[model samples]
Target: MSVESSAHTAAPRRVVIENCAIATVDARDTEYTSGHLVVAGNRIESLGSGPAPAGLEHVARRIDGTGHLVTPGLVNTHHHFYQWITRGLAQDRNLFDWLVTLYPLWAGIDDEMCYAAAQGSAAALLRSGCTTSTDHAYVFPKGGGDILGAEIRALAELGMRFQPTRGSMDLGESHGGLPPDTCVEDTDAALAATAEAIDRWHDPSFDSMLRVTAAPCSPFSVTRELLRGAAELARAKGVRLHTHGAETVEEEAFCREKFGMGPTDYLESVGWLGEDVWMAHCVHLNDSDITKFAATGTGVAHCPSSNARVAAGIARVPDLLAAGVPVGLGVDGAASNESGELGAELRNALLIARLRGGPAALTVRQSLRLGTMGGAKVLGREHEIGSLEPGKLADLAMWRLDGVSHAGLADPVAALVLGAAAPLTLLLVNGREVVEQGALSRVDEEEIARNVTRAVTRLHGG
Candidate 1:
């Protein structure tokens, strides 16, 4: 596969993907075994079974979709891109102890390391069929040299859609938080920087490539003042609010002892339990907590692999979906999950839900929905990018089912969820091909891997 930057030129005025199995994932869950999807500019013009639309016959490019399965591009709701360099450290530690072990090492991060890590992680995600991802980078070393900007730059260079959260941690170990003082920032400085980032990078328009969110690190690692201030700032800026909530039992206990309530209640008290807020993990919610999330339209990013790796209890996904909570998929951090692959995360979500409940816990279609439409809803972009509809963005993933892994499957869609992982044959963001033939189009994966290795070695004192 050739690697070339696709962002410089506009996509072909029209593109027609013909003779593929299309999973529309629309409101009615429409699907077709042999169909065509027509794209005019950045939006999908039309898609249906049978021959190509009348005027699309003369499109500049017509990709032959034989032996391919087409679906809406996957969306990742939560991630920590910097953690890509710390994947194997703190092998056996749980949430709190894991942070204790890695906080010191994270303090050594610089702008170069941030760029390398984001490139490596985003490249892996793009190869695995994730076109849009939200990276919650909460560690702001006092003089880390614009780590957030470096990450955004890398994402742009890789040609992936991003929502990079301006995450902060103002309470340190000196103030009963888990992170060290070196990694925490002054409250006012953090808020001001966050606002500056939104002003500089946020694009609220349709089919935007980059958006910014304001995120406080976590309940135990940040102060109440920072939480309230971030929520107010995000709302005023017209962006969303994101944070870590109900991820572990220790976090829930800390919320109870410090705030005289559970995690959900504390979130509500901080003015963060609303439609514009989406939380990560959420493995420890109770019945009332689920009710509050559903009623308030708050979203949840379910990191099944990370929760299982850290031994955090499984989230009640069945119950959450049953209660009308908008639930999406996330790989969390590479340090926690050891990989940032959304395809594998979708399979893990299905297997873990069945493990928690019975055989009828979750369906393959439901798991796919969580990775696509559910993630768009969680990030408040459902109107533009979730489904493969006439007016939606032409972001898509094409998987080749002719490989050995899916040779004998009767249903390609079910085989995608049940079979072993397969690399995406093609991926597009806003009608531009960022990944083609299972490789990144704009960046060299070998160079990214080498740079990330050097950064990790430097951080590890090698």
Candidate 2:
């Protein structure tokens, strides 16, 4: 499938996916059997099964999505875009061994590599039906590099909504942290960069293009003081705080050994339990921790593919969702999952939940919901971009399902999860098409693969 087709119409025009079976996921009449989705000026004007509103005749361009799965653009709550260059190298290793083997390679990253990796990952994600992504780029590697700016620029070119965390790895092995000293940072520099990112990018408005969350890498990679300070700094700036917590049994052991407490206990002591916080992985949480997270409105980014890849236990996603935990989907990192596709995460999430909680435990709708609305809840952007209502941003994905795998399916929604990735025909972010016909609309994706290939060769001595 080539993406160089006519894009349904000419550019600099009002685009509409007309006669599509619109699935708004809104409160009333959410599913439109066959209707028009008018994207006049970056927002859905009116979507329903019946005729359009009074004067919708002025749509300049229209693409028909009659046999497609249309929904709110999927949100990626967690990711390390830079890791796309280093995937599959440290295979069969647990978290500690995994980090140990990869840290050296990661220490060599510059802004160019970060930009290329983020562009590649963002293209892959959009091709898999994701429209918005939040990247956790915590590894600065003590260089004169601008990784965040590179990634932000790439995403801006792609027209994806970006929420990057000013992540820091302050505590080195000398300080009982996981990263080496080269990858660690001084406390003052870390805090300064955090403030700089927030001041430059953090947008509190509803139609924000990019936002910065102060992220200390994890419990094992940061100090208690750094964690508390990051939280305070985030609160002062009104941004979010993110980190890793209880991702594996080994992490649990590390926390108990280092802090004399579990991961949740250490986080709670550091005032990390709050509505403005969300953690990645979260595979080894206890019952009490679940309760605390739910009560405090803390969110979790559930990464089934990454957990299973490193042999981390399958997170009790069922229990977490049942316990009122705001659970969202994450690919974690390409190094762990080897696949950064957000729709791939949906498939893994659905299957893994069913494996643990039986067939009725997770449905296709629920899985897709997790990637969209659930992710928005985790990011506190639910009211803005999760659904396909009129007021929401026109961030959406259209997966064509006319293939044999989905041809005979009675319901499009059911076919979406079970179908063979459904073949993304178009992905829109803020009414702009970033991907068309399963390829990036802007940068050369094949060139990205070639660059990453060369980068990997340099990374591990070819």
Q: Pick the candidate with the highest TM-score.
A: 1
CA-lDDT, candidates in order: 0.90, 0.84
Off by more than 4 A, model 1: 1-12
**What is the lDDT for 217 in model 1?**
87
Model 1: lDDT of residue 117: 94
Tens-digit lDDT string for candidate 2 (340-400): 8888888889899888889988888888788888899999998888889877888988878
Who wins the lDDT comparison? Answer: 1
Query: What C-alpha lDDT, on a 0 to 100 scale, does residue 439 get in candidate 1?
Result: 81
Residue range 1-462, candidate 1, lDDT tens digits: 222222324445677788888998899999999998988788899999975777533365678787788999999999999999999889999999999999999999988898999998999889889989999998877667989999999999998999999999999989888889999999999999999999999999998999999999899888999999999899898999999999999998898888889988998998989899999999999999999999999999999999998999989999999999999999889999887898898889999999989889999999999999999999999999878999999999988897888878878778788888865888889888899888889988899999999999887888
* Per-model TM-score versus the true fold: 0.97, 0.94
Screening candidate 1 with a backbone cut-off below 3 angstroms (N, C-alpha, C), the clashing residue pairs are 4-441
Colliding pairs, model 2: none
What value of lDDT does candidate 2 attain over all alpha carbons?
0.84
